[model samples]
Target: MNKQMTRAFATGLLAAAIALLIYLYFSPTQDLSVEKMKQKLEKDDYVVVNATTYHQQVNELARLQKEISAMNKVKPTIKQKETKKQTTSKQKTNSYHLVISSGTTSAEIGQKLEEAGIIHSREQFDEYLKDHHYATKIQIGEYDIQQSFTFEEIAKVITKQK
Candidate 1:
């Protein structure tokens, strides 16, 4: 009787597992169509900008890029005039925005940092990354780096290591 009961329990458990698998196999997946996506976005209160707005934004971005390029090319000549008493003023710190996507290498990141005046030499940065094993551990995302950060801090930030 015990042997028969054990056999029955095993059969029932196996049947239940098979039923679960069948049910899962035939279940409907989430709708991934464009219309459904639009609906979801609307439901989440996301605004979809019109073509005119998009075009205006693009133009503004182009203008900003041109201004940045012009600034980079021009070297300002400053005439220092010493006042009676120098006021202690806080200097503004510069920050660079970096976007790293899949397949982005350390060399590219280093070059961008160098161009942004965040890093002195791209080659040295690359070498540091390679030596520290951070080249392969870099996370793919956007990073805001202050000009005061050292190479170690930059590497830690890019690697999401805090």
Candidate 2:
């Protein structure tokens, strides 16, 4: 090829490349706002917990688990069992109606249980659900829960075991 023809071809290719770059730079695009991004994540069922809160939850869960293990190690005496049975019989009338939906969270369920006097601590219940991997397995339905039910029983019931 001639030198002038080669130069013309190179310049044309360079010009086309620059034109393409300019077109890409000037193109209209959809900008994702913070709220829109958050909404999109929520729509996709993604939860973003902060690091501090997540670490705190982990520490609290560990402490609660130790306490649970200690509690489990203690055996109830016959008298304690009898007393518990009597108290449970009396508390049977205290029924809590729990409605779990698609967007329900463990924290909200724990809070509701605590408010209904079905569970002692919301934090403990939340930690238990998270620790036992039942947080994501909770079924969406109406549950007739009694105060006499233990956390394990409650978890099983809510997870569709009952």
Candidate 3:
């Protein structure tokens, strides 16, 4: 009777292992792709946050975001001061020469222009270049630009054929 019982238990274990293998082979797990994730984001109303951040303090993060919004509502506006030093600096930035390095990207050149105060925003300069398809046509050389020059004028000067 003991031998018979032992044989039955061994057969049962083998059958269970085979069943598990069949199930796994029939139903494979899936990985989420970028397109699928984008679709889910667009279709669903779920609020997503960093996994580790949410696990730590989701409530605190929400509160901080609210406080930031409140602060932005009361943000101070800039009022230009007409000091002598300010006037001198403004005059210096008016007519300046900028050197464009070889193989530099459009964003980098835009940033340089913004830093020199020849343009208001780097993003605006970049957009102007892209809209006019001059991003790839910028040449490496010295460019003389004034602070009052429009982005279009700057782009033209930078991309002109030598």
Give me the candidate number with maximum lDDT. Answer: 2
- Model 1 steric clash pairs: none
- Kindly provide the TM-score of model 2 when superposed on the true structure, using C-alpha atoms: 0.46
Candidate 2 minimal-lDDT segment of 10 residues:
70-79
Q: Which stretches of candidate 2 lie above 4 Å from their native place?
A: 1-89
Q: lDDT of each model, Cα atoms only?
A: 0.87, 0.91, 0.81
Tens-digit lDDT track of model 1 for 68-161: 8887666332212222122112113458889999999999999999998888999999999999999999999999997778899999999999
Candidate 3 ranges beyond 4 A from true positions: 1-93
Model 2 C-alpha lDDT per residue in residues 56-138, reported as the tens digit of each score? 99999999999988777664565689998889786877889999999999999999999988898999999999999999999
Best by TM-score: 2
Q: lDDT per residue, candidate 3, 1-162, as tens digits?
A: 699999999999999999999999999689899778867986897655667878669778888999998877665332233455566777675876888889888999888878877777899789888988999999999988877677777888889843
Question: lDDT of candidate 2?
Answer: 0.91
TM-score of each: 0.44, 0.46, 0.42
Model 3 scores worst on lDDT over the 10 consecutive residues at 75-84
